[model samples]
Target: MILLDDVHKTFGSVHAVRGVTFEVPPGQIVGLLGPNGAGKTTTIRMSVGYFMPDRGRVVIDGHDTRESPEAARSRIGYMPEATPLYPEMRVADYLDFRGRLFAMDRSSRREATARVMDRCDLTQVAHRRIGVLSKGFRQRVGLAAALLHDPPVLVLDEPTNGLDPAQIREVRGLVKELAAKRTMLISSHILSEVERLCDRLIVVSGGRVRGDGTPERLAAAASQEREYVLEARFDTDESARGFEAAVASLSGVASCSSSEPLDGAWRRFRVSARADGADLRESLAAAARARDIPVRELHALTPSLERAFHALADAGEEANP
Candidate 1:
């Protein structure tokens, strides 16, 4: 639904986004994760056509953002980090105005406004002045405006920036609901929010994409060292070595080691995959059966997203410095 290919952006000497290239497919929610000043905002702006990339392409729903910006932008609903809204305008009135800006007809405007109001939970304050509404409501109003046109793609940057705990939870649920229908890209520093709502995550740092994949996949791919864990219905010293040598022969299996057995009945062994992304669970199970060793489970255990992200980001910093 969205693609950025070799995109680059600069502010004089500052390169805010460098060679960014990734894609968000239909029915998928991708998290754009980074710390402050990591070019996440800049990358989003470029994707939304607010700032043209210095090089490469930004395509939204098959329209090239640079070649046909209007068509591309019309397909997107953007809630910027700042969450700008007309303070004096009533919630309903503001959304109606936004719809009009999209050149929507009277009936279309009404229907769109109603749909987004319901989606963002703005109906309770439909007539309330945006300025008088609480910060949480104001954020909803902005979200409503963004949705007024019913765009197929949504780019939300810090959608929960200033909300209290309850408000944040509400907004997160709203975003999750929207994800069921739209292709969404969430750019937020809050890891838990991203982890909960997004199927995949892209970690950015120093104006570049340091890593991009599902959180679990990224964690596994980023690690140099590996762990092997095994489950078995039986455990014995000689039988263990028989299982170990059988496991080591499997493709990508490096080494299996464990001094003591787990729970005296189950044994846990760690095997380093000789190749990246190799799955050895099935091999281990088959080999154990061949030796009459009752096996239970075997799989590689990778670190968490937080741990993987820290490892990649720290390496990025060291390389740049």
Candidate 2:
């Protein structure tokens, strides 16, 4: 439903987006993730027709953003990071005014306002002034405004920002419910939220897309090092030292570090190996048997989405620098 084809944007000396291209198919929820200075906001602005791309083009539902800015924008409902709302207006009044901007007739505006207020859980505060509403309610008002036009594409930038845990979950559930019928592109700094909400992720950094795939695929691809933890009880200090040395000397092991003795005689060790290394559990088991050490625990930690995000961002910075 949305496409950015080789899109590039620049401001004076700073290049904000470079050759950024992605497509969000119908009924899909895609997450846009990146570090602080990455071009996520720029890409979003261009995609929504808020900013014109210096090169390439943005297309919304087959309408060229440059040539048909109105048609393109009419297909999208955008809620920015800091939602702009009038504190003096009542929740229903604000939504009605937004519908007016879309040239919705009085009857249509009333219907849309009522529908969105219910959808966004703003019906209870319909008569309350926006200024007196809590942060969560104000956010719901912003979301209700965005939905007033019933656009097919929803571009939400940090939809859950600044909300408490409960509020975040509430908004998250609402977004999930909305995604069933429309295409969505959400930008968020929260990796866990993205993992839970999005069907796919587009990781951007240094003005370009560094990674794009399902969360599991990206995490696995970025895991270039494998880590394992082993706990064992040793007969003497010399035996523990010897075990550490033996594990570190193994052909595939990159590094191994041990923790202070837990309890009295049980020591924990963390081992790291290259991505291509054989499973270290077997090697460690063999080493423990050779030393007659009693193994307490041995396990490998799984790669996580946060690790993948950082690794991709690091790669982008290195490439750009």
Candidate 3:
């Protein structure tokens, strides 16, 4: 539904985006993840026609953003990180005004207002003043405004920022619910949130895409050897110490290095195991449990996106240094 071809942007001597290229399919949630100053915001702004790219092209649906801003924009709903809502307006009034901005007729405004309020879970506060609402409620009001036109695609920049734990969970759930109906491009600094919500991830650093794919794909692409990291808690300290010996004796495990004990009876260990190019989670769990060891948690300790990102970003830095 969205495409960027060799996009580039620069601010004086600094390149904000260096030859960015990607494609987003319909009805899929793609995460644009990176640390601060990674050109994610630049990419989104250029995609939405807020900032023209220095070179290359941006297409929204079938319309070129640069050539047909109106056609491209009509299909997109954007909610920026710092929500720009009219604090003086009532929540429902704000949505109605936004709908009008989209050229929605009176009847269309009413229907769009009702639909987005329900979508963003702001129906209860429809009559309340936006200035009087909490930060979380205000954020929802802004999202409702963005969705007032019922656009087919959404460009969200830190949609859950500054929210409390409960509020963050609420907003995250709402985003997932919205994703089912529209193509979403979410940009956030929270790794856990991206891991939980997005089906595909695009990790950017230093003006380039460092990693792009499913989590397992990135892990497998970066892993140089077969390795798994496991953690278990035993009945006592002695059981924890012997956990590595027990796992090391397994058929697949070639070596194990144990880490310091975690809180309670829990401890951590890294096992270099032979890979059969299959999922080894269940096998490792079963092996850990056989030695009277109560396995608390087990995960394939493949190299994470964080590791892959560091490798790529570091390479760029050294090359550009």
Candidate 4:
């Protein structure tokens, strides 16, 4: 349960967030994605009560961030992109200290510290100095510190920033588990991770929301063409050129090009179709059969998250500029 209504933030002449509005309902994980200067951090800061929006409201669970910073913040567990930690302090001790900062009572602090350590897999390293731990371990410590208060909403920026593949997967699993009880807002540069973990995405660019929807919906809306890869055996270079020409001339086909021979006689080709065109594999295969060309592989490539993100961002640039 988080909401931003026409939120706007600025620093000097730079307007970081402009008329941004979105809502994260309970039990949902929404990914925030954008390039470097897209104002994601600024927006998150306002949502967590670290910064007050200049023009609109940022309400956490029901508390207005500006009017009730403490209440709003109490509902959120924020783990920034580069979480600061005390290298000299032991992990368990550090978490306990954080609990105290949250105004947790001694009994509550002790219980929360132990629960977070176990949940974050930090129990084994409970007494180890944070400074000597690996980056992944440190990340876990930061995450553990955030959970000490048991907030209902989590705002995590680059939560998997310093972890290995296994650790990343572990964090992914943990986030998924937490989503059952807490609303989550995640910002990550990793598209694959976002696609896997988030139920929806909000793409921002040039201080505004450029896209918002499920990954498939956004990708489909942004895609202007469908791409396919076709690999087949050719008798000679001339035959390959002829095949390319034939495929390129097919109805709805936008372009077709061949690459150098792969393996031995098999050559790969890329075919693109207009945005409104149906699948061309059947027609391409029929034409090949008419020409007696031996087809080894043919498949349509789905629109990827990276491609959709760029398309939406570029659209924003053009519209704003």
Candidate 2 residue 257 C-alpha distance from true site, Å: 1.1
Clashes of 2: 0
Whole-model alpha-carbon lDDT for candidate 2: 0.91
RMSD of each: 5.3, 1.7, 4.6, 1.4
Q: Write the per-residue lDDT of candidate 3 for residues 129-193, one digit (tens) a residue.
A: 89899988888887887788878888888888878898788888888888887888888887778
Give the runs in model 3 whose Cα sits over 4 Å from its true position: 229-256, 259-269, 272-303, 319-321
Structural similarity to truth (TM-score) of each candidate: 0.76, 0.94, 0.79, 0.96
Q: Kindly provide the TM-score of model 1 when superposed on the true structure, using C-alpha atoms.
A: 0.76
Output the lDDT of residue 139, model 1: 83
lDDT of 2 by residue, 255-300 (tens): 9988889998999999999778888889888988887889989998
TM-score of 3: 0.79
Clashes of 1: 3
Q: Top model by lDDT, which number?
A: 4
Most TM-score-accurate candidate: 4
Candidate 3, after superposition: displacement of residue 87 in Å? 2.0
Predicted candidate 1 versus true structure: per-residue lDDT over 1-321, tens digit per residue: 999999999999887888999999988999998877778889999989999999999999999998999999999999998688888888888888888888899999999888988888889999989889888888888888877888899999888988999988888888888888789999988887888878999998888899898887887777766666777755458777777777777777778765467776777777776656457776767777787776667676756677788787776666555
- Per-candidate local distance difference test: 0.83, 0.91, 0.81, 0.92
- Over the full model, what C-alpha lDDT does candidate 1 score relative to the true structure? 0.83
